[model samples]
Target: MYHYTDFDRQFIHQRAAQYRDQLERNLRGELKDDEFRPLRLQNGWYVQRYAPMLRVAVPYGELSSRQLRVLSKIARDYDQPSAAVYAHASATQAELGTPHLPVGHGHFSTRQNVQFNWIPLDKSADVMDLLAKVDLHGIQTSGNCIRNITSDALAGIAPDEDIDPRPYAEIMRQWSTLHPEFAHLPRKFKIAITGAEEDRAATAWHDVGLHLRRNALGQIGFKVLVGGGMGRTPVIASTLREFLPWDQILNYLEAVVRVYNRFGRRDNLYKARIKILVKAEGQRFVDEVEAEFAQIVAHDGGQHTIPQAELARVSKHFLPPALVQPAQAATTNIAFEFTDKEAADYQRWLHQNVHAHKNPALRAVTLSFKRLGFAPGDATADQLCAAADLADRFSAGEVRVTHEQNLLLPWVQATDLPALWLAARSLGVAKANIGLLTDMITCPGGDFCALANARSIPLAAGIAERYQDLDELFDIGPVDLHISGCMNSCGHHHTGHIGVLGVDKDGREWYQVSLGGSDGSSLSGEAVPGKVIGPSFAASEVTDVVEALLDTYRAQRLAGEPFIASVRRLGLAPFKQAANAVRHETRDGGQVLHVHLSTVDAATD
Candidate 1:
């Protein structure tokens, strides 16, 4: 909701102009492929498997109606022809009250950004121009620098939130954007912040995670966690600083990254992440960071302090809207009526997609992009526009993108729930499965990404199709089934209750399974790294394997036990047995060798 100042707008346009020149040069053959690769990547352009992919950053996952319209326009006018079957403009244009243009739709990613898969290199500059029109850009979205900072999707509105993390996130954004020292690092760094009771932002798995909590005196601050990441080496971040005063956040962050930049490995690209550094040094890493913070504070007489005016400036932009009525009073007073079908459908959605808001009169609704048959996070241009229109009508013209690859209408009145659900259903986004198995987090695997060792979308589809029955999913209960095409962990498989990672074994596509992983939300221990169940499964058996695991959970779980809790209690032994039973089916009247349980090789591509 933070509008750009004149200085911010001017700075973004200038950067766009610079990138446009670089793109023009590259296209004219003045720059060779190798020479232009870094330039293009810095601007978020990648030559994917079938076509070019451009990722556009959505800061803190927040979008205004105007920004959403701009995204729809880009999808209409510029997306390549092959993926533009539903790229009609009249419907979206009508909703946006703008002119109809022919283009393609965009895919939202788990990182809370939009990616256009079929963009042409020639149109890169044009895309940049379009994004700049809405005060958005792709800078820092790619490269070995800080990527977009993520927070809880329901950040400001969550009922149990101690403080809104956006102002601090924005402040960090201002400090980290194009910071000269960190422009190029040994590996890309990521940061996440969460102010809610639950770790909705997956703070435990980030390079830097700021968990805000109130002290005994009711002053808000952060519980800083560092070195947690997933890749070849998956590690939960250790507590770097237990309770960092809110005012010194930037200063503390500066010290942490500074230490990393100075000592982080640069020889091996695979082990260059801060996580590796933390692992190697252990307690010594924490000591070094604390020492650095002291030095910084001592120098220049505590000069890195955040100004109260600056905090106020960012905080004003995130002020909650006035509530229409108290939620309890409204629910009690409303004369509600519903048809049988409507009541049943609405009830399912209300239970799955709606979340409590701090403002009792308002509820946050998740508009799921993970409908059956579509890619997990993709939304057609019309769907995007329809969401924008619905947000304008019901949520005061604001929408949020969740780190789980879903869209959230953050401030809908309780009274408008039925109308919003109906409209969302028409757009094919009302799937009534927010935390269920069908609501998976997946990456664009071998189908599009060149780095992928196996296709992930098909695997995700197969799994979703297997569990399409809502009754079965509800029975299964809350489970995080995350799949990644490779060890890059773009899909965050390392944090799922049921984790699946694609691999290439002897030039054949296979998938490895892990269980008991979580996204850092538990009454007990959370963010527990998953253990590999057994050997990799063939593409054909992926669904069968998932079914076997779920079936085992259904049979073994205690009453009302969640999938994660079941996994923790039962351990990997039961799931491993189920997977092994399914993996050794006789083929062509021949007995196949059963895969033995072993540690997953992180080095596998």
Candidate 2:
């Protein structure tokens, strides 16, 4: 874990003191709500449904054991002992759990980013004091600020990475932390860096997604994507700079943020993301902004220069784990032991859950959260603590939160599988259905989020319940059933193999189903939904519809065909027909059409 420098310490101390004064004034009613809103927001405080929520930036989801302990302590001391901890990019509260005290502290993988929900307004200063002592601060966690600079969690360790991205991420973090030049942006901005060949950083879904790559000259550089984001209007980022030199990253990013800060919309909150700005201004305008910033950087060589000394300094902090000599191959490992009974199971999990590591003997294991009945991406406090323990015991005392809302033990020894699996099973984190139909990425709809049109958690729960048999689920193969409450696409419904987006039709909730969406480097984004089905079905009906669609696809598909590939090949007509046929056949008949009477009766009830 990177420690804060004196400069970092000074900056946070000053910010905390400033916020403390502001908070005191607000309590004294000297500052009105309107006046205090931005101040609190700048400090990562949001006035949510129940109480003020504080988001503590974790900076790329890499947490040391000590940091995890601090978070656990924060939850136990300040909130309820059972306060939930969720992985980043998981669904909101409505999709996860009931409203409660010590509200959940979600791991916003942005795990790199840390946020705290339900921080008592009066106790916020105390919370800050506690965080400050531990070298953690919420300086640029929120507001119209360059929020936490996110990077690929597997940046350095992934086998196919071009270079370690943590050092650059750290550089960006330092440069952007309370940056004076563009703090007052028209909207919040986000930046992501990924050195991995895989787009683990959700590069297409950020304001700036930097893919570290090498040019023809063989010098390490970045492939920069800009203005990509998700909100009301979702757009995949477009390439802004191809192969920007390593030294120019900060200057270029500053230029980009500065342009958005000056030109992004502030009057309309809904249209305030950088994507909207880019869309309105056109790519050419964005190019001009970059050009302007580049000129500035060129003029002030002192500010933008990447000093060799600084690079060396930052690199030392993010140095890869010392390489160890190859250990003897364990032919009698867990995989061999479970070859007959669990081999097939383990193979499926290995294919989807395990990631290639920089070291051949080591592998990164993904703990899938998509279980039979639990909401996707959810873990109770006990589960979280257990995960922390697992990381400590088995994975070199570090843990990572994936963008898919799952935990990753990035450095698990290949030989420790059996014990780790048993321990994980004890904690309810041992589901082996990573990337299978059961491994869904869903959002919390209507339940806790004010933005949802319908409840998505129940929908996911219903689906999981329908396919409770693991054998049946595994047979279905790689199926992604992503459901989102609204068009905001937080659940990434647009990228599911079978995407379901909840919509409110009049007063009744309905679902729109799309096919062939995927979130990966080669093929990202899905086609628009071909069929809008149901004015909301009963839980059983929803499952039946999904089953019918799956059956239809299975019946018509070729061997070795994935759901998305089959859908793409066969088109959505068969699936749509199957879904509608089931819905129509299942619809209750001979029901009286007394709309006025029903309305009155419903109101009375």
Candidate 3:
């Protein structure tokens, strides 16, 4: 709910105008493909298989209703017609209903941005124009720069928050937007901040994750972790600073990035991320960053100083909206009643999607975009508008995008949850599966992404469909199932309780399953990375293999134990045995090959 200042608006408009001019020049042949490539990528445009993909930034996953409406309008006006080859990430076009827009629907990403898959090059400028009108842009969304800063969706109003981290996140966003010193690094960098005791933002998976903490004297500061990432090599970040004073966070961050910029590998793109540098250098890397921090502070008093007034100014923008008194709201809603089915469903929804808020009268509700047989992170234009309208009615015209690819009305009054749930259900965005296995985090796989080695959408869909039953899902309990199309780890597969990675095997798609990954802080003091099980399986056999893993968990798990905890307790022996035991026969009678399902284009719901 941060409002754009005059300076902010001017900066965005200037960038949009510059990009427009640059795009026109490139289209007119004044610039070659090589010349235009970096320019386009910096603005979040990618030339994929069929057309350009434009990823628009939604800072820290916060958006106003007006902004959401503008996004919906962009989909309606500039999107191309849906294609058979690339429809929903989960199901075929025919099965999910052919989307009129080229991108089918706005594909929400794990980074809290929505990607348009089939954006035409010429019209990308128009898309930029549309985005500018609503205080949104694609600045720093791509290229080797600090991408959009992400924080907990429940930042300002989470019950356990020690301090609101959004202001700090915004402060970093402002400072890093176009910092010349670190503009072109060895590779892209990412940062996440979590204000709550719970790690909703998956801080450990980011290049730098900051957990806001309060000292004994009640002064807020940060616990910094660095070098964590997922790709060909996934590694958990290590402690950079046990506690950094809040006011000096910016300077500390600058020092860390500087160290990475100076030593991060430039020889190979595969080894370019800060994670690799940290791994290669070990404790030496941390020592260098600390030394840099000291030098920065020693010279010129302080390179970066965030005054209290500035913090107040940013915090004001994130102040929670006024809400009705909890007692009054409870009394008013107490008179209401529900039918048997409605009561049961509401209970399930309340248990799953609804979460506690800092204000007693208010509750944060997660609107599940992961419906049965649909892509994990997709929202049609109509659905977007509907969400905007709902937010307007219930959440002070503000909505939030979760890193998990769902919409959240963070300031909904507890009394209004039933009505909001009904409205969300009507729009097909209300599913009670938050934190459940069905609530998978996935990326646009081989079906839409040219970089992918194998199709991931269909496989994710198959897994979701196989466990579509709510009774089964609830019984299975909380599990994070993350799938990636390729090693880019766009889906953060390495952080899931159950991780699925797509790979190329002699021109065919194969999936490698990993067990016991988690984004949340470990109950065991040490950070754990997901370990890959046995060999990869064919695309057709993925769901069955996952089922086998799940069955193993169910059979061996102790009462009330979560999936990840069970995996940690039992190790991979049981899962490996269960998965190896399940077998599927191929159509070529003599030659046995396992084929569980077809591609997304040919598959049904």
lDDT score for candidate 1 against the true structure:
0.82
Question: Candidate order by lDDT, highest to lowest?
Answer: 1, 3, 2
Cα error, residue 324 of model 1, in Å, equals 1.9
- Residue-by-residue lDDT tens digits, candidate 3, 254-360: 88999999999989878999999998999999899889888888985776978999999988998777767555324224334688887778889889998888787
In candidate 2, how many Å is residue 255 off? Answer: 2.0
Give per-model TM-scores. Answer: 0.92, 0.85, 0.92
Instruction: Give lDDT tens digits, candidate 1, residues 536-563.
Output: 8877787888899999999999998888
Among residues 3 or more apart in sequence or in different chains, the pairs in candidate 3 whose N, CA or C atoms overlap within 3 Å are 80-102, 540-596
Candidate 2 deviant stretches above 4 angstroms: 13-18, 81-119, 326-351, 372-374, 506-508, 522-541, 586-605
lDDT, residue 227, candidate 3? 91
TM-score between candidate 3 and the true structure:
0.92
| Residue 412 accuracy (lDDT) in model 2 | 76
Question: Model 3, 343: alpha-carbon shift in Å?
Answer: 1.3
Weakest lDDT window of 10 consecutive positions for candidate 2: 596-605
| Residue 588 lDDT (model 1) | 27
Query: After best superposition, candidate 3 residue 156: deviation in angstroms?
Result: 1.0
Segments in model 3 whose C-alpha atoms lie over 4 Å from true places = 81-104, 326-337, 521-527, 583-605
By lDDT, the better pick of 1 and 3 is: 1
